[model samples]
Target: MSMTLTDDGQTFSAGRWPLSALSVASAVLIFAVMQGIVLSLTGGVFDYPLDDPYIHLALAEVIAQDQYGVNLGEAASPGSSALFPFLLVPFAGTEFHRYLPLIWSGVGLIFAAWLWGRLLVEAGYGRAEWRWLGLAAAVLGPIAVMMPMVAFVGMEHSLHAAATLALLLGLHRHFSDNGGVGLILAGAFFGAAFRIEGLAPGLIAACALFLTGSRRNGLATAAATLLPILMFMGFLVSQGLDPLPSSVQTKLSMTDPGDEPGFIQLRLAILLVNLREPGGMFVAVLALASFLMWRATPLKGTRWGVLVLVIGAAAAAHLLAGQIGWLNRYEHYILVMTAAGFLVLLPKATQGAVTPLAIGGVAALILGGALAYRLPMHFFELPPSARAIHTQQGQMARFVKDYLQTDVAVNDLGYVAWQNDNYVLDLWGLASAEAREIRTTAPVPGWTGDLTAKYDVPVALVYDHWFEDGIGADWVKVGEFQLTVPGGFLGGYVVSFYATSPDTVAMLTGALEAWIPTLLPHSRFVWAEGMEP
Candidate 1:
C-alpha cells in the first residue's frame, strides 16, 4: 500500500495496479448506488430533490413543441445551463427526461473517477491496486461524498464536476507532456452544455494554454467553450429574451444593494461567507492548496504557475457570479473542483519534501471533517422534499393543464411550468424577462399589478405574502395547497392558490368542489377560509 517516489516524483517501477483505475471506479459506483437507492425509495427514478431541474425540462418541453418557455409560444431564458434544454430535446416531453439527469450523475461519477486515476498517477500519487483501494477512497473520498448529492439534486452539476476535472488533467498534460488538446476541447464542450458557470474551469485552462504559448490549443479551447454559449445566447436574444438567464438575474437581485452595506462590501462579505460555508474545511484546504500549487511548478513555464493564476482568476469569477448557501447547490461543482485541482498539485508540490502518507492524511482529515460536519442528506429530509414537489407543484401543474387550461401567475415556476402546457406568469421571474426587469430594473408604479395586468393572468399560485396591497385585493384566495414541506429544499416553502379572475374563481371552485369530495380518504387541497365560490 506504500508508494516510494524518487527525487523527481516518478516511480522507478510500476506497482500491481499500474494505474488500473479500479479502486476509484469502485468507490464512485458504491456511492452512486447508495444515492440511487435513496432516490428510488424516496420517490422513484424520475424524482429529484429540488424543482430547478424541472425548469430545464419545462424549457425542453417548450423546445419539443417548436417553441420556447413554459407557455409553449413565449420564448424565454429560464434555466442557467446553456445547452441543457437542447440536451433534453429528445426526451423533452417524455417520461424519460426526468430520469436521465440522474443517469448523467452516474456517468459523471465514473468519468470523474477515471480522470482522477490519471491525475493521481500523473501527479505521482502512486499505483492503485486492491491494497491501495482504501487509500484511494481516503484521498478521493470528497468527490465520492458529493457525487451522489449532485446526482440526487438532478442538475447538470455532475457533468460540470467531470468537465472541471478533465480541464485540470488537460492543463497538466499540456504543460508536462505537450499533450491534451482533445481533452481540453472535450472539457470546454462540457462547460458549454453542462451549465453556463461550468465554462469557468475550462475557460481558465484555455487561458493557461495561451499564457504558456500554446496559442493553437488555446484557440481551440476558446472556440469549443464560446461557440455553444454564443449560439444559445444569440438564440435567446433573437427571441427577444435576456441574454442572461432568469436565475442569474434573480440571484443577483437577491443580493442586497442597500446604501449601508455598499455593493462591493456586500459582495466581499458574501464572498468570504461562501469560502467558509458549505463546510469550513474547504477554506483551510484551499488555502494550503494555493501554496502547494505555487511550489509545485516553476513560475516561467510550469502548469502549477498557470494553475495558481487560473484558480485565482476563477475565485474572482465565482465571487462576482456565484452564491453559496442555497442548500449548498449553487456553488457545489466549482468548490469540489477547486479542492480536487489542488490535490493534483499537492503530490508534485511535496515531491521530495514530504512523505506521501503526510499528504494523504491531510486530505482525508479535511475532507472527512467537511462530510461529517455537513451531511448532504438525511433520511428525514427525503420524503418531505419529494412530497412538496410531487404532491403540491406536480398537482398544481396537473390542475392548470387538465382542469383549468388557462394562463396563471405562479411564484414557484418549475414543475407547474414544465408539467402543464400553460403560460405561467412567473412572479419571481425565473421564466419571464419582463417580470425580472420589472422587479429589478424598472421603477414602475405598482409593478406587480402592472405585471398581472399585462399578462392578464387568470389564476395566481404564489406565496400568501407575495401579492401585497392592490395586487392582493384584486385576487381572491379560493383554495390553498398546504403540505409539511421542508425549508432546506426551497428558501421558503410557500405554494398558494388564488383566483385572479371571476371565471378563474368559478373554475377552481368547481374543480375543488368535485375533487375535494373524492379525497375523502386524504388530500392536501381545501378551500381558502371563507372564500370558496
Candidate 2:
C-alpha cells in the first residue's frame, strides 16, 4: 500500500503518536497566542473577526430557542452553513460559545495537520525536523495556509479546511491503501455540513477517487458524496426552507444576488489583488517554477494530460461560482486548494533530492512560515479591526429598541439584527425576502422611499451611496455614525438614519439631537432640515 507519493527509504511505523500530539499542541499554542493578542486588544473574544459569524450565532440562538431565523417564528435560512448552527444549539446561549470557535479552530487545525503529518511520514519525511513541517503548515505555510484567520473568523471554515486536507490525502492514498473510501466519505459528509461550497471539494475528491479505482469504487464514492447532500437538501425543503441556504443562493446570484463581477474576471481580480501582497508574489513565482518543472515530476496520479489538471478541477469548481475577497473569508479556501496541490505535486518536481521533488514541496512551506509567521504579513490588520460591527451595530440595535419602537431596515444585518428583537428589513437580502427583492430590483432612489413607506418601515440605517437614484431628501437624515480606521473596510463609512413619516422624522430628529451628546460623543447629527416628508 505504498507508491510514488508516500513511498521512501523507510516505511513509517505506527507509534508516532507523540509527534502527532506535538503537532496538535503546537497548533493550539499558536492559535491561543494569536487570539490572546486579539482578545487583549479587542476586550472580548465574542467580537469575532467577521460579523457574519454573528448571523449564524443569532440563528443558532433561535434554533436553540426552538424557533427559526434571526427573529423567532420566522422560517428563513439566515445561516449559509448546514451543520454549524445546529452544532451550536447546545452552546448557543452559554458562555461556552464565546470560546467554542477557538476550540473548533484549534481542533480543526490539529486534525488537518495530523492527517498531513501522516502523509509526510508515509512519504519518509517524518525523520528529524521534517516531521514538524506538517505542524507549521497548519499555522503558516503558503499564503493560503490561513488557519489563524479561519479560526478567528469564528465560523465553520476551520472544519472545512480540515476536511479538504483529509479528502486530498485520502484520494492520494486510496489506490495504495484500498481502504480510504471511508475517509473520503467522512470528509465529504462533515465538510458539507459546514458550508454549501463544501460540496465542491468533496465532489472533486470523489471524481479523483473514482479515477484512481474501478467503476464500482467511483459509484460508491459518488453515492457517499451525493446521498448526504440530497438528504440535507431534502431536510431543508421539508422544513420549508430553501434547498440551498439563503446565504448560498444569494451569493451565487440566484435570488437577488450581489454584483457578480463575471467568473473569469472575478478570478483574475482575486489574482490581481494577491499579486499586490508580498506572500502573493512569492506564491506566484513558486507556482510558475513548479509549472515549468511539472512534467519532470508529475504527481503519482494520472491526469488526462497535464499534471496540473487535478488542481485545475479545484480552481474551476471554486472560481466558476466562488465568492472573492469579502472580509477575507470568501476566497480563503483557495489557499488550501493551492497548498494541497503543491504538497502533492511539488514532491514530483524535486525527485533527485531524496526524491528532491518531495523536498521541494517541503521547501514551499517556508514561504508562508516566513511571511505570515507571527502577526502575519497582513501587517495593516489590527488586533480588533472589527470594532465597527461591535460598537456601531451593537449601539444602533439598542438605539432602535429604546428610541424608534418600530421595525427598521438595514444593510449590515449581523450586529443590529442580532442584538435586538426588532424586525429588520435587510436591504442586502441575506435575511429578509422583501429586502432581497428591493436589492434585486434596485429601486430608483425615491422608489425605496415608497417601498419603505409601503412596508410601514419608518426608519432605515444605511449608507447613502447604496441607493443610486437617492431616497429623496424628504426621507431626512437624522444621524450619522462615523467609521474611521486605517485601511479598514468600514473606513469613512457613515451609517445614516433616515425617516419616512414626517411625525416619526421629527421624533427621531429630536431624539438624535438629544442623544448625540451622550451616545455619539465624537459623532455628529446631520439634519436635512426644511425637507418635507
Candidate 3:
C-alpha cells in the first residue's frame, strides 16, 4: 500500500500500515541492541539507567493499594506525571510491572512513526526516494529527539513525543483539509497527562487555530489540553499538598516561592541555559531558519503559515520554560516537532528547486552530526550507566531492605524506596514537601539534620558535598559506598552513609560490615575514621 497526497498537499490517503510496521521493527531492533549492551555489562539484569522509573513503580504500588506516595498510606505527589503511576496501577506489585513502561513506550513509538509518516506523505514525500527518506525519518523520527533514549528510560517521554506529533499532524490536517479537530483534542489531553510540558505544544497549536479563525476548535482544544493538568493539580491540592506535583515543583528551580528572582527573570535565566546547550542552540537556529524560509516563500499564506506559527511558538515556549537535557529525555517532543516542521517546510520553502539529493545530503549531515554528538556515546554508556546505578543505588536498596529494614533518610530516593516497604525520607525534595520547603526556603547549617531528626530517620545515604551547609552535627559519617565502575552516569561516584546520631553508628557499621561481602563487583564500602566493624 502507498499513501496518496492530494493536490493541495493538505491531506493523504490512509496507507501508513507499512511505515508503522517498519518503525516498530526498527525500534525493536534498536532496543534489542541496547538491551544486548546492557545485558553484557550487568550479566543480564534489565535496569533503567536512571532510577526515576522505579519511583513511578513504587508510587504505582501505593496507588494500587489506595495511596499516593512511595511509603504506604503516605500522601505525597512524588511522580511528576499525575497520570503515569495510575496507568501502571494494574500492573503494580507484579514482576511484569517493571517492563510495562517499555511496552507503553513501544506502543507510542509505533503510533508516532505512523503519524509522522502520514504527515510526510501530506508534505508530498509519498512517492519514490522521497518516500524512503520519509520512512527512515518516520522510523527514527529525529536523531536529536533521541526517541530510543527516552523509550529506554522507562518513562512517559516517548508517549509525550508521540502525542506532540499527533497534535502537529492534527494541526496540519485542520489547516489544509479543515478537519481533524478531534485528533487535536485527543493529543492535547493525553499529551498533558503524560507530561505537563506537553501542554506547551498543545496550547500553542490551539492559539494558532484561534488566530487562523477556528475559534470553536481552538477553545475546545485549549480546554481539552488543559483539563487533565488542572484536574491533577486539583487532586494534589485536595491532599493538602501543593497544587503542583512535588517532582514538577522541585525541578522548576525558578518558580520556588522562596526564590529571589522574579518569575520573568527566572524564565529568562532558563532561556539562557537552553541557549547555552549545543542541542538547544541547534534547534533554535533551525526553527529560526524555518520561520525565515516560510516567510520568504509562497507558502506563507494562511494554511501553511499556521504550521509555521505553531512550530515556532512551540519551540520558543519550550526553550523558555522547559528543560533541555537530562540524559536527552526532556525537550524531546519539541525537538521532534521542530524537525518534522522543518522537513515539511523544506521542499515548499525551496519551491522544489533544491534537488532531493541535496536535501537528503544536508539532512544526512545534520542527523549524522547529531547522532555522533550524543546517540552513539550515550548508547554505549547505557550499560555502564545502568551498572553504576546497580552498583550504587541498587546496592543501597539491598542494604536497606535486607539489613536496616526500617525508615531511613536519603538524598536519592528511587531504588531504596522501590525495594523496601519501609518509609523513605527523600531529602532531595522530590517525594517530600517538607524537605523541598526547607531546601528552597530555609537552607541553612544542619537543615538536613533537622529534617531527618523530625522524621526520626536514623541513617542517611547521601552525597556529603551536596550539603555544603552540613548534614547536621548529630549526623556522623559512618561509611561510604564507592563505585569502582568507570564511565557511567551518576550524581557522584561515592555515596556517603551517615548515622543521624553517634549511638546509631555502631548499628550502621555492623550492617555495612555484614553487607560488604555481598556488594556488587567493583563497588565497596569505606569505613569512616575508626568506625570499621
Best by TM-score: 3
Per residue, candidate 3 scores C-alpha lDDT tens digits across 1-533 of 66555545544443444554565566666766887788888888878888888888888888888778888766889888867888777767667887877787767766666666667666666545455555665566544456666677788888888888888878777766747788899989889999998888888888878877889988999998899999998988887878988888888764333457787887788888888886687668768867886777777774677788788988998888888877767877887788778777765665544565427634753574365346677677776787788778888998999988878998877888884788899998888888888887678899988888888889999988877775887899987889986866677899999899988888888788788888778898888888776
Decide which is better by TM-score, 1 or 3. Answer: 3
Largest lDDT belongs to which candidate?
A: 3
Better of 1 and 2 by lDDT: 1
Q: Compared to the true structure, candidate 2 yields what TM-score?
A: 0.81
In model 1, which range of ten residues has the least summed lDDT? 514-523
Q: Across residues 1-533, which tens digit of lDDT does each residue of candidate 1 receive? A: 44544334455443556452663555465555555655564455235667777888888888888887877677777887876567777776667777666666667766766666666556555533322533553344544345545555667776776787787777767666647678889888886667777667667777778877888888889889888788878887888888877787787677654546876788776677666664433534564556555754443344467776676566566655577544455665666566555655554564433456435644564556356435545434643465455655666667777676778887777877776756688877888877777666753544665677677887787776654542545566787666543433653455567776565678778766665543311136756788765
Local error of candidate 3 at residue 520 (angstroms)? 1.4
Worst 10 residues of 3 by lDDT: 10-19
Q: Which residue ranges in model 3 land beyond 4 Å of their true spot?
A: 7-17, 139-141, 254-259, 350-372
**TM-scores, one per candidate:** 0.85, 0.81, 0.93
Comparing 2 with 3 on TM-score, the higher-scoring candidate is: 3
**Between candidates 1 and 2, which one is better according to TM-score?**
1
Q: What is candidate 2's CA lDDT for residue 276?
A: 59
Candidates' RMSD to native: 4.1, 4.9, 2.6
TM-score of 1: 0.85
- How big is the RMSD of model 1? 4.1
Computed on alpha carbons, the lDDT of every model, listed in order, comes to 0.64, 0.59, 0.77
